[model samples]
Target: MRSNVLGSAADFRRGGHSSRRPLDSHLAQLFMRDLRADAPPQLPIFRSRLQGELLARLLLGPDREHTMLDLAVMLRTDLGSVVREVDRLARAGLLTLRRTAAGRLASRDTATPLHEPLAQLVMHTFGPKAVVAEEFGALPGAAEIHLFGAWAERYSGVAGEPPGDVEVLVVGAVDPGAAFDAAQESAARLGLPVHPVVRTVGEWRDDTDPFLRQIRACSLVRAR
Candidate 1:
């Protein structure tokens, strides 16, 4: 089903874009089809990271109808802690809170129509090179996916624009060839770029100057 849709979309992209971004219009729509079903994937579950994630979510817009106490329960934290954070977040201008009918402290949805800004941000901040490298770090043994090259930058966004682009580096033992061809076909259709780096465990360990490092200049050092 997906393949057919993608193929049709690609057929429509004869020359609508510069480079390979023509598929973006359709693909972006497809990817966004169910994005808001549950926005939890965007949050950090770690106790320490929760505050920042919540704050980011507010900046990105979470339901403002709910109060901070409701949010505290959702966050599984004490109401007092949520209140403190709410105070801090409000001061930062990322969120606004109000008392709900249930007497809970809820956050105001200050988030703009975010998908566009977020997509652009993903691209602008990561750049094709660093985005790919970081992707490999998460995927492990991801060197083969590099074949996508410039297309990777297409999805990941140009080094600093952060809009209309998203870079993803998939490592692990996934088949690089299959992934590349799939991405190529998809890129031709949806126009999103996915730069992958797939390698064997041996390849990653065999050389100190890993392929990922070849693009080292592009990335911020991964947090240990």
Candidate 2:
């Protein structure tokens, strides 16, 4: 009887209790595959850089009101392009324009069921890798940079809440003052706190430290 119980346990561990697809709530491999198969494709949004970036910003801060000029300036794109893409997205029902007391504001349409899912997809794919690379690429003495914590987990498609902060691990003898200053500027732009943790290569390689071990266990996105 003990052997029989052990075998059943092993089956559950290796391939699940029967051959049927696991429940979605369980988050098993089969369940995740099924979820992906059932999900609507988001390839259209990614086809255009301007559209993709605009959607990302909208989803990132759904509550905030975005103007045509504001989005154009933030994305570093031309006004004409921003205006065209905004019209397209608005027509597609992904965004809505409101005549506010201050001016016109473009905001994500929360009423659509696609709002949450689309946001998750955009954030999972285009999270913070590009921004981090652009921010820290030219920093002196920074040999490598990695993104971990909530952002990394979301980027890897692990279901979680939107990241409230950006955490990066820099493996090199980088300047903390410079790192802090850069992080502050990045945080201001991103509307979230940017934290850069500096560590030597040797320190990073040493897995004996509890914090390092924990970092090693989670998903990481390499920026450099």
Best by lDDT: 2
| Candidate number achieving the greatest TM-score relative to the actual structure | 2
lDDT of 1 by residue, 1-224 (tens): 12332443465455444565444566556433422123233232222334443443343212335566555655565665566556654554545566556764545443645435543342333233333343343433344434233334344344433223333444357666755654454333222345434456555454465555554434322211
Off by over 4 Å in 2: 1-48, 61-63, 76-81, 110-121
Worst 10-residue lDDT window for candidate 2 reads 31-40
lDDT per residue, candidate 2, 106-212, as tens digits? Answer: 88898988887887776654446666776877678888899999888877778766777899888888888888887876665455678999888889988898997
State candidate 2's TM-score: 0.64
Q: In order, what lDDT does every prediction score?
A: 0.43, 0.71
* Candidate 2 all-Cα RMSD: 17.6
Q: Against the hidden reference, what TM-scores do the models get? A: 0.31, 0.64
lDDT value, candidate 1, whole model: 0.43
**Model 2 clashes, total count:** 0
